[model samples]
Target: MIEIKNLKKVYAGATVVNVPQLEIKKGESIGLVGNNGAGKTTLFRMILDLIRPESGEVLSNGYNVAGAEAWKNYTASYLDEGFLIDYLTPEEYFYFIGGLHQQNRAQVDETLLGLTDFFNGEILKKGKYIRDLSKGNQCKVGVGSCLLQKPELLMLDEPFANIDPSTQFRLKNILKTENKNNGVTTIVSSHDLNHVTDVCDRILLMEKGVIIKDIATSSSTLSELEEYFGVGQIVTPEIKVDKEENH
Candidate 1:
């Protein structure tokens, strides 16, 4: 449902993102993996049209993202806490978003009820502005908001980073259901290898602002990724020779 071509972004004389071409089909779950400065977030921003690419374009349903508003109707994304309305309470923010989507308060409540398990009893009636919540709780709020939208295309960045293990598990299940049962096209960028691999059908390994490997998920995908990231490699110390003594 999404296509990227000749996409490139640069910062301060350095190339940060340089994707030549990529495509994401409907109902597919894609995982983007990379270290810091790999340009994963940059790529995401370009897709969302939050940042204009220096060259090339992103297309959603064959319409250029840079030139269309139709894609926003079906896309939901939460990249960081910056996406939250920090001054508003979680409930208020959710209701506002719901209103924008033409969902009444009752509708919003019903949708939120379905996410009770995902919220883990920490979100609703918190009696605090979103800014006051902990980082993990804020992440929960962000993700929860995305679900309330019932988007056709969902994109999240580092979603597993701040949440607890149980919440992470719940989120993974939610993603799986959204992709498999609901046919949502999902693209998630994460540093958590295990979680990403478990939820995504395909993995894109990126480095130095380029996609280096794109692998279909399989029994061996995790180990292959770990090996690429040097998870289990052995390192031997270098030995020094006494050249003068030998002479």
Candidate 2:
């Protein structure tokens, strides 16, 4: 379970995100949807402890995520290409992560069996640095590595941004399988409603860094969410600034 209390972040003396409270239970999948720069990535970064929050706490199963190293081992995230080691091949990256988790090659191979088709037998081959791989292939490596350890809490930011439709569908099934069988708590942030609706048990809608709507997918329709986001308010292009640009 993940609990966030009054979480807030600031950049250059300006408030970038604030969430009063939120609790995501075990085996639950949640989706975050917002316009560009609405703080979805900021919130995800805070949860993963990659970025510090100016105020409040994030707890995973009673462990303070921002206060301990144990949380790092149990929390797995794949937000962008930087998460992958650009200098290493895909197989090398997997072996490196496996070593960190104290897993042998056979165990790593077993864990990676589900992804073999995606790798197309090339991930085990040598000679290609991760940076030389295509964006979609890089994402596959990042994702495969994150799941290599079977962490309890999984967080992904715009995971389907560069992947193809077939892989996106495969990823959706993989997320569902993980959540169902392993009871992993998953939080996914995406701009695409179809992706979210396909896998998320709950949906949180953000506007200008504030969560304006939280709906249970079982009880809500996609059209309802569309109406909420499409309220005809004029959102200026001023909100399009990237996180680094704003920093």
Candidate 3:
């Protein structure tokens, strides 16, 4: 269970995140959606104790995230490439992270077996360092490492941003399967509305550092999101003119 109360963050005298109160029940899969600068990442950072909130607190299973060590045991998150070791190869990186979670080599190998199709054989081998892999591949490595931990609370930011379409589908299935089997609590933030809606059982819409909507996923959720997003927005197509024609 996750409990947030009066959480706030300020930067240069501007408030970026402010949540009076929120509770995420155990075994819930939640998707947070918002445009850039909506404070989605800020909220995740607070939850993971990566950033010090200006006020209030975040509690994971009754343990304050910033004040206790208990939450680290069952919570895992991948917000960006910074979580990965660019110097290590994917295989080496996995083993290193797995070791941190007290997973032996054989157990790590077993955990990785479930990710073969997600990797598409491109992540492992190829004799490349993590920094050398493409951004999409690096993201795969980060998410795979997080999953290897078998966390009770998993968090991801923009998980679909750098992945290919086919791999995105596979990753969704992976999360769904994990939820079905383990009831792991997941909170993932994404700009890709369709993908998040497809994976999450609940959707929270963030706007200007506030959660404006919290709705359960349903058959009509996509259309509802589309309708909500379409309000007061202008999408102008670029006009292209041939150089010769312009001359």
Q: Which tens-of-lDDT digit does each residue in 134-208 have in candidate 1?
A: 899999889888988899999999999999999999999999999999999999999999999999998988877
Evaluate model 1: give its TM-score: 0.93
Which lDDT value does model 3 have at 220?
83
Task: After the best TM-score superposition of candidate 3, give how far the Cα of residue 126 lies from its true spot, in angstroms.
Answer: 1.3
**Model 2 vs. true fold: TM:** 0.90
Decide which is better by lDDT, 1 or 3: 1
Between prediction 2 and prediction 3, which has the larger lDDT? Answer: 3
- Highest-lDDT candidate: 1
Error in Å for residue 27 of model 2: 1.3
Those runs of model 2 whose alpha carbons end farther than 4 Å from true positions after fitting are: 120-122, 234-247
Q: Provide the clashing-pair count of each candidate structure.
A: 0, 0, 0
Q: Clashing pairs in model 2?
A: none
State the lDDT of candidate 2 residue by residue for 87-206, as single tens digits: 988888898999999999899989889787666565657579999988888888888998898988888899888888888888998899888888888899998898898888788877
Off-target runs (Cα >4 Å) in candidate 3 are 233-247
